[model samples]
Target: MAMDSRRTHRESAVVVGGGISGLLAARELAMKGLRVTLVEKRSHLGGAVGAHEVDGHVLDSGAESFATRTSDVAELLTELGIEDKICSPYDGGSWLYLQDGAHPAPRTGILGIPGDLSDPSIREILSSAGLRRAKMDKLLPASVGANAKTLGELVRKRMGQQVVDRLVAPVTTGVQSTHPDEVEIESVIPGLQAALAQRGSLAAASASLRAASPAGSQVAGLVGGMNQLSEALVRDVLRRRVRILTGYDAIAVDRDPDRGGWTLLQRAPQLGERVAPVHGKYLVMATDAPTTLRILGSHLDASTIPQVKAGHEIALVTLAIEQPELDSRPRGTGLLVSDQVATVRAKALTHATAKWKWIAEEMGPGKHVVRLSYGRGNDHGPLREVSLYDDQLITLAMHDAGKLLGVSITRGNLLGADVVRWKGSLPTMRPGHREKVQQFRNSLQDLEGVTAVGAWLSGNGLAAVTADTRRTMHEFIDATSAD
Candidate 1:
């Protein structure tokens, strides 16, 4: 059913974003017997967690899996009735491509930080001198790098620069699209410092954390695709009668003093020269940091508005190839390329068919799917690559795929190819990002019935976003109920 032609009168909650976080928030509000309206600027609901069709095959365009460090995402999947579809990647471990060459990544590690420095693979990637420096992490006192702010700082102080450049840099750049120097140690690995303090060694702490996690792959995805999670959330929220307004952008927001609620000024092409006012007793700003600040800036004090760094512009090039050599899975699931490697432009590549059995089965024999990601946070050189024409990017991806996979792949072998670009979707969590987020959240306490949640605040990955959204919504529900 279409929304009413005029302004909505005082809904119990208004979620200004239709991403996963916003959808989950709307669902939570509706479940608590509150009328909710979900507004999204894009025509589609899911933000980064979306799907695209390439070569007659539907694939996840953004996030494809969730971390299993916590059961938060798994439990949510169970509630959504798709838990049975959860599947793991093949047992083939990933690889790392450094300036030297390609080598298998350490089997037991977190974010490329080897849990056991004695692992033979570590010797293959690091020089004898580098390995000697890394082993010093075990000898160093726990308090040596205790107060280090960034992950790069902590690792360099504990291990060495070689380890940071060759090991950690590839993983951080591949996964987060940001360098380790810009990543907060605590934000990415919670309780790591405390663990370091207790274990008296960084390597020991990493091993302990890895051991505590659920057995098998640290990440998992649905049999179909993670896009199903977004679709499922949309379906569930609609069943609860949550009003969903796509293409409706919340341009301005303010407090309704007389009504003791919130008012959002929304504009859309569909509205055509008219702005619609949406009123609600509660508000959830589930947008990216920049857009959220734009709408709520006037209402927040100048000092209270946190300075948020812009996210990187990422372009993913996916290729479906009919390469018989790929049947051997030369590089395992895929390889994370070090930024220092001048030979390859892509920071990472995932052998989709080799990584996911379902995808392999869908493609049948002799057909393979590979995805290459291009972009590094705050790096304009890579931004230029992502800004290239679709055909140009596809050609570049094909070259990079051939180099990384050790296979001769040409256009003749390429059955189909596509490029998907995402802007400001993967937020960069700088060294002090978590502290700034906390300060910003504290400032919102003065604004009654208003809260904020997203990757910018909760850190990256589906697990962090899902867990944080549910927890924040539950808290909001409790606070609103008490009043």
Candidate 2:
């Protein structure tokens, strides 16, 4: 019972926004035999993850590095044949800032969860009492079957407050730019808790989990700058026969009461002209939450716009300096700040040059590049500019971080060196986020053809979620085929 539903008429569709999501979507649609147009507000293709060369050094302005655990990203590279650009992370070691010294933080602990905390590496960082709590993992009765437990409640109950404060807090914040007490445990630490609850002891469960481990390094990166991946998407999508508009900003959408298709109105600053009206049977909104609301402002309902208003706030800045100074930041995988440590706004750090050799090569023979990220800007705003002279705030962080990384600064050159600032963009998982997104889904059903996807649908992290959206889009296209 083979079904032949391929439509001979190639319907033209437009993908709004040239970010990763939009670029990916355009590629997928064009591959399905549709004429696709990729539009971007900015002149460049890479959104958060972009790169530029200055003084013979290549600098990643937004996102600098990504972990290898993302299979979807890897697959995309393979599909684009850009796999050779990826370089493995240096096993140079990582350090953590604590009371007044730098200690090793676990990077290969299998998604921040380890099978045995009794290992010397883990023991070196935790106090005796902390170690005792970690050992107690074997004694605590695990849940047989039930809803997932929060990381705060579960880790503190099993691994003790120190481990949670010292370990999980920083790691989670770095990855999601979110604090622990607020982030959903099921969403962040998925699989660990559910499996722990089922096994009746986290230690036993971890041991069992480790047995099924894959044989390879846990964290890896591209051979060139991490931005190369984004560049490849931009490159390949164009070759797929899709028209890309970089300076065209979509300002509004209108319905032709007479025709059922959408009228996409765009403003191209570069051209200093208005975009010729594009009539399309299908429209896909892949811009971030806030931007999406503005573009769909006129066409969508008031109730519909509020859903886009709810978002996440993450303040991330990348500081590029000489190799020695860049080496001056936390080395290895970097440190994570514990929630219990007075304030909990900042999280983990990674050596950009050390992590991504390709980008590092651009730093010259002895120079280095690194990214400094801090979440919850409202809290860090007044304190982020902390000074070492008389300001206890900056002094406090400098003292803590310096000791952890084992360095003393003789000048201001090492502290901020050459910082690139990007204010926080808060990402929210409020009480009714899923519900609101569902409403957004329903609102579009009334329209003739529209598709939406990205981190807004699920959680952050690139490849996996994009894969999920592609699957859904394929299903949608199949069901709506006009054969």
Candidate 3:
């Protein structure tokens, strides 16, 4: 029973990027029986989450794991029935690498926000004054609490600067490439904002956040790599016959000019000279921020996304080190970079096996795997300067991890390391980013089939992008499906 392709009323969707958001969007739309085509510029799918096996060790392009509290991702996994495939961070423990190397985080801190900086447990990372300021969180006004603000301001207002420079910056930057001075608190630390606005005090907020953190709790990831999730997602919908085009770069999306269905001109990555125009009833641009802006052209105006220059961000450099000495038995997850402190050297290291316990638990034996990652900030340029040589990275990682753990590292041996740098990671959502976000949102109404989705909305990291993508999909579905 072949279907006619010429049916005027045929339903279809073209997801312009093969990133996680794009994958999710395609899955959801395909499940609803809409003809779906996922177009990715990369020859390989899984935008930033690409994964491969190099010499029997799993290598990932981005964060090896994803946080689970955002039920949107969890719900999606459950719906796809791959919920069992993802594993959580080891509840037994996790470590945060500091200036020295690797050290156990305080058992009571909230997302690295100290429950009591005074507690001798974290005194090594804070001063006496800082500890006292931790108690002053109740005084800040709640109105601007959730508003865009720098991590420095957030801590200086609610806790203190010492805490900001030490634990928060070093750890949080592992996820965001910008510094505390640049990383919007609202974007990076959503818990703090919610605590201040909803719960009304820093202490109350800390308690609320502490309870939700992956620390000493189960965190999650796919078996091979985080990209496996994306692959699985794509595979699920493919059985339903969703069209997928890989290695094709969508150049521009606009009206056909002559006929009227939206047209997308794309050049396959390798076959660049072969540019072909694609048309669809509706188009979902699941591209990165810059490209989305480029495609918007005149369609971009005050009515849609803001004119503000999207903050330049840096892609991450992940080093997979097979060090038995530095690596513990697969138990918990890894560490992060405090963007401000990330110098010419290493950023931070979070244990992958530790972060996702399933990967570690199932290992045969004598295989101690760890993901040593460094985030080159937006401040750095040309990537080569920030890029790390295998030995150089190993040295810096050891220093950074040693600083956190407050110990010498003679144990783990170095496996191989790889680097993939995405120049435009996301916009830096400074305080007042929400206002810009409003402007960005308004810009979309004027565009017929284009919908922008990325971490740029939050201007900080990927977790927000996941939640926002879920919301954006609904918005697109509503807009495109309406009469």
Cα RMSD, model 3: 4.3
Off by over 4 Å in 3: 1-8, 92-103, 138-148, 197-200, 302-304, 307-333, 337-344, 361-365, 378-385, 388-412, 458-463
Tens digit of per-residue lDDT, candidate 2, span 399-452: 444433445432353324333333323354543556677787777666667777
Clashing pairs for predicted structure model 1, backbone only: none
Off by over 4 Å in 1: 1-11
How would you order the candidates by TM-score, starting with the best?
Answer: 1, 3, 2
Q: How many Å off is the CA of 340 in candidate 1? A: 0.4
Question: Quick one: best lDDT, which candidate?
Answer: 1
Report the Cα lDDT for candidate 1. 0.88
TM-score of each: 0.96, 0.81, 0.84
The residue-level lDDT of candidate 1 at 315 comes to 95
| lDDT by candidate, in order shown | 0.88, 0.61, 0.62
Task: Flag the better candidate by TM-score, 1 or 3.
Answer: 1
lDDT (tens digit, per residue) of candidate 3 on 280-375: 766777777677767766566635555545544333334444455444433234555455444424555555555554555544343344445554
Q: What clash count does candidate 3 reach?
A: 43
